[model samples]
Target: MLTTSQILKKVKELEIKSKRLTRHLFTGEYHSAFKGRGMSFKEVREYTAGDDIRFIDWNVSARFNHPFSKLFEEERELTMMLLADISASSLFGTVLARKKDMVTEIGAVLGFSAISNNDKVGSVLFSEDIEKYIPPKKGRDHGLYIVRELLTREGKKKGTDISRALRYLNNTTRQKCIVFVLSDFLDPGFADALRVAGKKHDVIGIKVYDPMDMQLPDAGVLEIEDAESGQVARIDTSDYLVRKAHQDAFFRHSEWCKQVFTRAGCDLLHISTKEDYVKVLQKFFIGRT
Candidate 1:
């Protein structure tokens, strides 16, 4: 737990760093990747050579005896929601910052990006259940508040329930939003809710993990514990078969997660604790462009 002053200082640091990224790194990429809401109907005009025939107003064309087309303008404002997982598993990291820290930084960056572009930003922090819900709001202070919450908030529950979080998001928000779910993704049974949410919103999955999560260090026999379940077991890392099996299982689970996101029509990004996430995020944005 962090003290009030410590939390405030950390929040300020993240706010400044995120703002810098928002200005130089994400400002344009974020805007281009996530367009404004679908075009809104405007006035109708006589059809031009370049206009699509499908949009022709049949009734108006019949009355005027000329082809007419409907025009539309893009809605400027958008809503962005961050769904962060604060489960016990996120507390384990072997290199760099922990998974939770990475998630918080990424969430702050997204919030700053949204607010910088004059969009409403909100968040739902969850573990086994929703821990806190911040209503969508615009302005710098709201963004700062979100950063503070991300830094100080702790998960009360042990396990992760991504399905519950998705269902809550679906029930709470009606309008289309750019939803970003950040987690280690060490949970199960979320595909259905993810698919449903994807149908309504632009869902993106950001999976942050450590190298140790996939491979075990050759430290001979060691005791390993499950962070969420509190189950402890001893594993002989010196044994080649045990290491191979652990690696294989981790790889299999990672692939399965990718498929789930793909089936739900969501974009997925995997970042390791040892890597530079800023570059990864920049690459993702550029790819979207």
Candidate 2:
């Protein structure tokens, strides 16, 4: 557990870092990468040489005996929601930082980016239930508040229930928005909810992981505790078969995650705790463009 002073110090650091990155790295890329809702008809004007003929208002044109083109404006303001997982499994890490730390940092960056682009930012922090919600709002202060919460807020439950989070999001918001589900994705049985959310909103899955979650070191027999259940089990890490089984399970879980995201028609980005997330985000933004 982090002390009050420690959490405050870390929050300040993250705010500074997120602000800098938002300005320099994501200013333009993030704005252009994702589009808002469908364009709204602004007005009708005399048809220009380059205007698309399909948009011509036949009734108006027939009445005036001249072609009229319908003009549309893009919905500039967008709402971005972050569904953050605060499960106990996020506390585990080996060679890198904890999964929770990575999620917090990435979420901060994204929040800042959204506000920088004049988009409304909101979040739902969950651990087997909806823990807290910050309604969509504009401005830098809102982003800072989200960063602070991500740094200091404690989970009420230890287990992960992504389905509950998704269902909550689906029911609460009627507006179409961009949603990012950030988690280690250790939970199962969320595919149906995810599919529903994707159909209604633009959804993205950000999977944060640690190296130890994928492989176990050969350090002889050790007692392992389940972070969510608090159940302990002794395993011989020195045994090749044990390590192999662990690796296989990890791979299978990862593969299933990929398939789930694919079936839901949502974009998935995997980030390791040890890697620089800015580069990963940049690549994703550029790829979308």
Model 1, span 1-289: residue lDDT tens: 7888999899999999999998999999998899997789888999999998888989999999999998888886999999999989988888888999999999999999999999999999999989999999999999999998888888999899999999999999999999999998999799999999999999999999999988998999999899999999999999999999999998898899999999999999998888888999899988998
Q: Candidate 2: where are CA atoms >4 Å away? A: 1-4, 41-72
Q: Give the backbone clash total of model 1.
A: 0
Residue 26's lDDT within candidate 2 is 90
- State the lDDT of candidate 2 residue by residue for 170-252, as single tens digits: 88898988999999899988999999999999999999989878889999999999999999999999999999999999889
* CA lDDT scores, all candidates in order: 0.93, 0.91
lDDT of 2 at 28: 83
Best by lDDT: 1
Q: TM-scores of the models, in the given order?
A: 0.89, 0.89
